[model samples]
Target chain A: MIITRRTFVKAAAASGAALVLPGTAPGAPPAPVMRAVPSSGEMLPAVGLGTWITFNVGDDPVLRDECAEVIAAFFAAGGRMIDSSPMYGSSQPAIGYGLEKLGRPEALFSAEKVWTSSAADGPAQIEQSRRFWGVPRFDLVQVHNLVAWETHLETLFAMKADGRIRYVGITTSEGRRHDLFEQIMRAHPLDFVQFTYNVVDREAEERLLPLAAERGMAVIVNRPFRQGALTRQLQGETLPAWAAEIGAGTWAQFILKFILSHPSVTVAIPATTRVDHVRENVTAATGPLPDASMRDRMAAYVRDL
Target chain B: MSEWWTYRLEDFLLFSPRVYWRLFELNNAASWPLHLLTLAAGLAIVLLALRRPPGHGLWVAFILAALFAFVGWSFLWSRYAAINWAIAYVAPAFGLQALLLAIGGAARGSLAFDRRDIAGRLGLLIAVVGLVVYPLMPLLFGRPWSSAEVFGIAPDPTAIVALGVLLAASGGLVPLLFAIPLLWLLLSGLTLHAMGDSQAWLPLLAAAITVAALALRRIAR
Candidate 1:
């Protein structure tokens, strides 16, 4: 039986489903969903914060403090991982300011990337990023977009071996160069692999996701909202009543839930500027995730819309 | 992987529109009353261009040189470079523009305006827009006055005013002056476009008009 939108809404209403907004529940919030790294079994909160365009606020004191509030709100909402890159302009320094402002939460998972084309510059750049973040060491360091990957990956691997870093991985975004990404995954023993994987852009489901699963590599999904394009498209559309079943109150959560529902996805790093959005994104990890059929339905609903 | 073609313009943009505009607000706040002087200087250039006074070219170039130096240090190096790494590389080009204006226009006295020509008239109009109209863009777009990019202090208006003045002037170095401002306009336009800004076309349109005016001037000559 095909479930149309009307039938789904009617059924959900009849069932008296309660729409639970993130961090707005009457009682205590549910424990955030944590997924284990396939390589080391180290658990990470499923919904992480991405510091891309959102945190590159430069030296504007007001915007920097706003970013700090976002960090405070994220940690308060049970988020652990915060991903950034040197290519993301002032984001590293902004993160440093935020972390310093927040007194440095112990549960923070610092994930950064090495993006220089020169192999020799990798270590220096990583050290600079460390200084920018004011962190002793990063939890994960990835080769950004596979630039100078061979040398950077070797350097990261050495860092991991020397315990300078916890995990070594690689990242690609906007679904570019997946062929080379697959080759690297096949060859190297990477701890993580990050790329774009959202409800709208599911190209990863065919090969990369399976490859990560097969190779026991944790997957970090980027651009889960296509860098806000998806949400803008879905804005003002009535949330499907069945979204309550998966505990998604806002569209941000609904989209994040779809990405997290995938078994291979270890984390989805959604970048946001607003403190409320950071809270909303973190809550996506706490709720009941959609099963295989529901995941399909969610994707279909988005596609049809 | 040498797959540079795979990258989109959005990939290179690392800041949001809010942050981008805030840079101007912060710059304006830091250089508060300095904007009045810069705008006054810009207006002076427009008036000078319109009147075609003797030796006004030297004064115009000197003022533009001063403005370029100020914007290069204040806006590009001090503020924008904090968020955009590429601006650091481009700031030196602005310095080069300042030096060129000083040597070619102020020192050599090569720049001279001919209001009798169509190019000069068009150039004067562009100068007026850069001086009088560009700052009003914020009001037109519903942004606060604090975020308005003004001449001499901000890179966009400064570049636009320089382009307009260069088009009006006739000199061996006039063509050379076109390169940096045009390039800056392209870069700024692309950056604003990537941010999904409604005013992205402003710089692009200015560049197109400048190029067309130059072409028409050449054809008429």
Candidate 2:
């Protein structure tokens, strides 16, 4: 009776038979669709939560509480992966504060990054991140933007071996350092790699993603909204008529489903400050994802935009 | 601690350029028509500097002090402190500048209009630019009027105006007034540059011109 990652995901998908809005349904909301890491077969919800600028509240209790509600909504919708970094000012600490207010849900799959040139300071930075998230150890610690990666990757590898962190990886976002990122994905024995991938920014689809699949590394897609550029550009536009077929009621869901449709993508973390946006984001994981043709159509539709 | 020195200018920025500018837009939205008053006040300060009435230094000081205090209380403390922790420490520096200006003015510090010199003329021109031209940046950039940055309400133009005032004034207290504004211009310029903001170069240029004019004035003296 050993339940594998596949069986767990199947059970979770079966539970997501129907979508319900907040406070409108009599029962707990539908569980999100889950994807398994190709490397270790550890399953995670297809949609993860990112804490970049959205959670950097800078000690404001009201804003902190608001972020806590966003976390609450995320977990309530069956989200597990909450990705953050030390480079993002006040974001990690705010995540800790939010988790504190939310009573530290057990589903938390905390992911953080070390961004320092000094190899000696890498452990201290990760320790600070641990303190910030109020977690005993991170589930994943990545090299942010590949800065001093040789130094930090060594630290991450040792931490992974010692179980201080469960997984060691690297990340680049906003399409920066992709050439080097691709090289690392090919050469290194990393467990996970995160980079920017969305409808408009298809550069990752060219090499990084396929390489992740080939290398059996878990892929986390970031900047799914292209840092608000996509949303702002598509503002005032109606959702596509066929969006309802895939259960995408909003653009957030629509775009997230497009990312999740990729076979290599384990999770897409869309950061947000608003609780409603979090609900919208997490609900993207609840329904049938777009297939290859729908993904092509989605790309064409956004290209014309 | 060893890695602290490796940080780039972008590392200090808490948000994107869009979010940063959106703060100015929100500030403008919350305080509409206050920009008009700020424009008028800036013009009045320049005019008073030109008139050189008795205790005119104190008059300009009173106005400049009030502007710093307003930026500290209304903008930095109320708006920015919510996002950036470094600004909370910097807000008190603005308060300190306000006090310094108060003391200099009360002590009859010399801050008279001097248009005969090139530095004086250049300084006055820069001041007027801050008073009139700074607010139009949002409109020129295709942004709504709600994103307009003005003196007394916003930091950039207020700092520029302060530099202009210092450059035009005939006083030993010029360096004291120049310190904080210049530091802010450098910091803001770096931050804006890192954010890929088009206005990034403006602060650096303003800082250069202010310093050059002040240096020219000193040489002439």
lDDT of 1 by residue, B6-82 (tens): 87898888788899999998888889898889888988988887787888888888899888988999999999998
Please write out the lDDT profile of model 1 over residues A137-164, one tens digit for every residue.
9999999999999999999999999999
State in Å the error of residue A195, model 2: 0.4
lDDT of 2 by residue, A101-201 (tens): 88889999999999887889999999988998999889999998888899888888888889899998999876777788888887889989999888888
- Whole-structure CA lDDT of model 1: 0.88
List the candidate 2 regions with Cα displacement exceeding 4 Å. Answer: A1-26, B1-13, B16-158, B170-221
- lDDT of each residue in B41-105, candidate 2, tens digit only: 89988998778777778888889989998998888888777667678888988898898787777
Assess every candidate by TM-score.
0.93, 0.71
Question: How many steric clashes between backbone atoms does each model show?
Answer: 0, 0
Cα-based lDDT at residue A130, candidate 2: 97
